[model samples]
Target chain A: MVAPVFDSGSFRDPDGHVFFYENEIYRTLTTDAVHRMERLLKLSFVKKSIIEGRIIDTKILEATKIFPKDFLVTEYVLWHEKIPYVTYPFEWTFSMLKDAAYLMLDLLSGLLENNFILKDGTAWNICFYNGKPCFYDILSIDTYVEGQPWEGFSQFLQEFLYPLMIQSYQGIDFQPLWRSTLAGIPAKLCYKSLSRSSLFKKGVFKYVYLQEKLSSNKTISEATLKHEFTHNAFSKKALTNLIKNLRLCLETLTVKSDQSVWKNYDSKNSYEEQDVKEKEKFVVEGLKALNPLSVMDLGCNTGRYSLIAADIAPVISCDLDPTCVDQIYLKKNSKILPVVLNLMTPTSSMGWHLNERKDIFTRVKSDSFMALALMHHLCISHNVPLSHFILLLRSIASKGIVEWVDKSDPMVQFLLRNRKDIFKEYTWENFQHLIREHFHIEKTLPLNNGVRQIMLLSEKKN
Target chain B: MNVLMYCLPLMATSTPCCAYLDAGSSSMLLQLLFGGVAGGLVFLKIYFRRLVSFFKAKK
Candidate 1:
């Protein structure tokens, strides 16, 4: 077995750090954390959660086998089931974050029934596995003390509740705000940004406005509240009611499904029925031949092709429009993950040493990808060179399909209307030459009276 | 600050401090208010629709 490498993103939690060894993910727990796990594991609720796949399945590792003698005796070792792909809150659609919030609240409510509580409510630990939200942090659960407040209350507000509120109430996308700061929308900032009229919105007055006012009012000494709560401890029933109230508040929130340019692209894209059939046929053939472990459909407008790829392998369908991506979840397809991702402005590696949170490029776990109708926008509109575009494709997947749109194509013409045509390298010959430099074109199919072509490609080893 | 302090009337009482996470004083204190019989019940009225939906799902 290879030496275990510590995961850079796992420094915040004191209980343990996650690491990778032998292609599997593992966690090293402090002895105290192991005791918490032991207590929780004995509960039928926790075991049932693992069986139902709401929590990531974990098992204590036998000390005699994997780790060296010294390391095993001191720190407890555990193996966690690895998720197929990891996506952050920034790339999530409104529905994705809402679903994650629901999962966290439900888990907390259920844990409290077993005399346990989640210590923290950070949004980072829940991941979408098979299009369902799954909580992965094992050490977050601990015995709930009587009269102690939900310790992660502010964190829940910052990470999940406040962000969703701003989006649903103000018609603003919270992704930009969340992407900028790890803590999510601050209560003060969120309250100030919200309109005074929104003070009447459901749960807004207390959860956001009141919470902000309360946090800033300084006179409410938290130390004093700590002492009082001990004397006037709340029953577990009351705490459960608080959780239910939060859950109910979140369920009422909604994001407007309007404001989408690509929401109806499948019908409005001007592709003839026969042309679409030809395109679908080409994608299916390529996927069948390669039979990749998974496929990522970049710029999957309304998930037309992602639905096709889902028939073959689990597909991560991504687009810049939340409305477009949200349609995938509405379809209720278990094989597809919908994410609101903008390729041109994908998030950079952030936090300490730029490794605490992984960059977009590294987290995409796909062996093959489909970039249908995406090249023209990246090259003509975004001004990325064809060489660099192909380079990105090769870096993302060993084999893939690229739909090359000619400069004369109507969509490309629309993108170039009344603008300086500085794309000298956008010609088919240049695209073919550039692609050939890095990849071997295995197959090609024409569409739309030869205005567009789909090429199956495999990266060439240097 | 004194004016606002008079209005809010801080502290239901003190509870033990929590773990590593910054449980922000206001958020922590609000829980005392929420855990009261009248408070969570009032909040539930705002989310009454959710209560309705929960029943619908059970059916």
Candidate 2:
């Protein structure tokens, strides 16, 4: 039998590590964690949370079955239900991150009521399943100690509150920054980046200005520091108020992007009513025929086709425009996972030793892909070669539906207006030839508008 | 005086305080103080409104 491979991302917590055996995910608990797990399992809230889908379901496994009996060092092992698609904070839209923050706060509030608290707050610990954020780390909760401050409070600020505040105030998207940093934007940096007028905002004075001042002050004596942690008593009422205030602050943060090209994409397009109906009919029929387990909709602006595809299978809808992704997320489609991703520069491996997080394509590859109205943007706008684009599609999915817009199309002409028309080979004939080299063309259909064509392709066998 | 003398040597000899409290402990301490006062005020506001409603009902 092959040895169980430990997950690269599960090494941070010393109490436990997740491993995969026979394609099944399992977590092995240290002796210390076994005791904590035993105590937590007896709690009614833990059981209720699992039932309500607020927490991932876990079943304890016999340690001897997982590890060689002589090699076993822990008393217990746990197996968890694998989420269909794991998404990172950097790929989430503003609304998705906001919802995740709310879920964390809600979980924290409930845990505190039951005399328990989270060990730390990291956005990575939460995953979206069934269109709602669910807390997955069973080991994160521990019994609350009297007079102990909320241990996760500061981390919550850096990982969740600060990023949201910066986006709401500065109108600068923080997804790229989060992707690069992985630890989240620091509170000090966020405070410095905000405008002077923004400091006067309702929660800014308390949460940002004061937090920055307190964190930077290094003159306090050791005695004072010890006193702060050991002597400070938090009444239950005060903790309740803290959670409520944080929720209210997050509730008021609303950022509506003003760059609305993709938000109004369907309306602004030159397609006639009959053209849209024909295109939709073709896509729906093609997807029904494929009947894939999961579909990845690349450049899914406003998720028009993604919503239609979700009825047959779960869909991962991705687009470069934050507003477009945010609109899809707000629609609350349970089967659709909407994310903000620029394909030209997708997220890469980052963190310790550059291997803590996997690259975008490695993390999410589907059996079927939909690249609707996305070819010209890559070939003309980004200068990606036609053959290279087809190769990437083949590498990411077994089957795909790709739309080809000939240079004669008005949209392609618009992309060429100011730029030099150097793409002389960007024609329908060349595109078909390049695509056929890697795929077997199964079907072809042209919309009512004669300038565009769609093709269904299956990867060629070796 | 004896207790102070005994404590002075221990304080001087001890290592520089770098006891590894995670990065956000200081902010969390400040929040505890602020949240206590805010929570008290909220509780008072709720009861005060209820008192006004009771008198209006009596009238």
Candidate 3:
């Protein structure tokens, strides 16, 4: 069964609800969504954008049966590839956000050329896949009539432009803004909160003041309507100029936060030079043995081991700390997807009525996984049984490089210094015995440091 | 190069004309040229700052 993970901020539709299923995700379209989907598919721009890279492929699944309650409609889309881990707009670096904004505008411009328009321009609709951002929501595309005003103009400014501007021009942190509002930071909120300096900057002035003024005072019914009429009266040159000004502002916007933790992880780890070398050699050998196409490193603090594996294959380095993910992501530039994950309570697949976001197990089936200096934390800190730990590891990865820290190790001693070691089952012998029941021990490497031992295990014979 | 590429959409948001030019706004080619130069300078400053520091340390 697909377990539920994140459920907040999901859009409500009459449809059956979107759920993450196995390797592929499905969004059960209700009658209303199905109707909209049908109309959307008819647009030529949709066809062209799909043919190009502007839109992600939306393939209708072949499932004839329906889930219980028949809450879904006649059709549902089986999304083959969802982002490995979902990252909200707030977590993005300024450059990344700017790139996403540009991608949306570029796609919109292409849709306009194809005589179509996007129904919305929220950054959430864009997900980073591979090294580039790709549009995922097919529900957001619709036919554009020439004479109609741009309906999503305000949303475009609020979701994409205003947030970027706030970070870029006013130097205000956008993270709080995103955390507070799910619909995106409101335009009026931005118009009022941003500093006056933001409006006077060389190129930022027109965008900060003019764009906000256009979307403000909806209830007042002031001369803003005439201003909008006059603004719309501009020739294609002027309209295009407006689009260009916003584009320039986005391109120059940069977030300069020196708050990354990974930048100084090497200096902070306190590993003796020789000990560090030994650990690196051990990790590299483990990675080579696994030969993974995709690997997940648990407790990948600052990604020391994850980057070693990333040299071989794409790695999803995850840690309990957000600061670690932020630093690793900035260093790698999205090559390795860094996510804030707690192994104790990993993100489950929860969305629209509890199915949109895929759970940790369903989202990944990595060929190789590494849990270096990690089991002690699970056993002693979290009180997970040795048997449960083996089963969980096997479930996540077919093969793994696991480290078993004996209770006598000083690190474990430090953990037990003040408290009782109720974990009699946390001995090396018990861990090895339990692991053998579920895995074939291929090789074991003992390090000079008495704290950790690495074992490579495969599922061939258990 | 990365910053200019990043900012193109922001520049394009209010001034749609800039959307077409990879450099900047399409309406004012001169301003686009100027923005391009400024952006390239920013990249250069970042790229060489460390290098300059390195040489100073050596000296």
Best by lDDT: 1
For each candidate in the order shown, give its overall lDDT on alpha carbons.
0.80, 0.78, 0.61
User: Where does the lowest 10-residue lDDT sum fall in candidate 3 chain A?
Assistant: A217-226
Per-residue lDDT tens digits of candidate 2, residues B1-59? 32332222222222223454235644654554454543233223334565687799999
Overall local distance difference test of candidate 2: 0.78
Backbone clash pairs for candidate 2 read none
Categorize the docking of model 1.
incorrect
What are the per-residue Cα lDDT tens digits for candidate 2 across A3-118? 56788888888888888766777888877777777777777878888887778888777778777656543567878888877889988888888988998888888888878888
List candidate 1 segments past 4 Å from native: A1-3, A70-75, A221-223, B1-23, B37-59
TM-score of each: 0.89, 0.88, 0.61
Give the TM-score between model 1's chain B and the true chain B.
0.25
DockQ result, candidate 3: 0.02
**Predicted model with the maximum TM-score:** 1
Tens digits of per-residue lDDT for model 3 on A1-462?
A: 333321334454444345654445566565565666666666676667666655676765644553334333344553434566556565455555667789887777766665556776678787666545668776666666543334455566667777777766666666557645644566557767777666666454444453443223221111112232232332333334445676776777676555454546557543568877877887788778777778888878777777787778888777765555556666744457666666887655544546654565665557778888778778888899989988888888888788878887766776788897798777777787888887888888776465567788877652
**Candidate 3 residue runs with Cα over 4 Å from true position:** A1-54, A57-95, A161-182, A186-218, A221-239, A273-278, A291-293, A301-304, A320-335, A342-351, A356-361, A364-367, A373-395, A404-441, A460-462, B1-59
Ranking by TM-score: 1, 2, 3
Report the lDDT tens digits of candidate 3 across residue range B29-58: 222223344333332343356468679999
Better of 1 and 3 by lDDT: 1
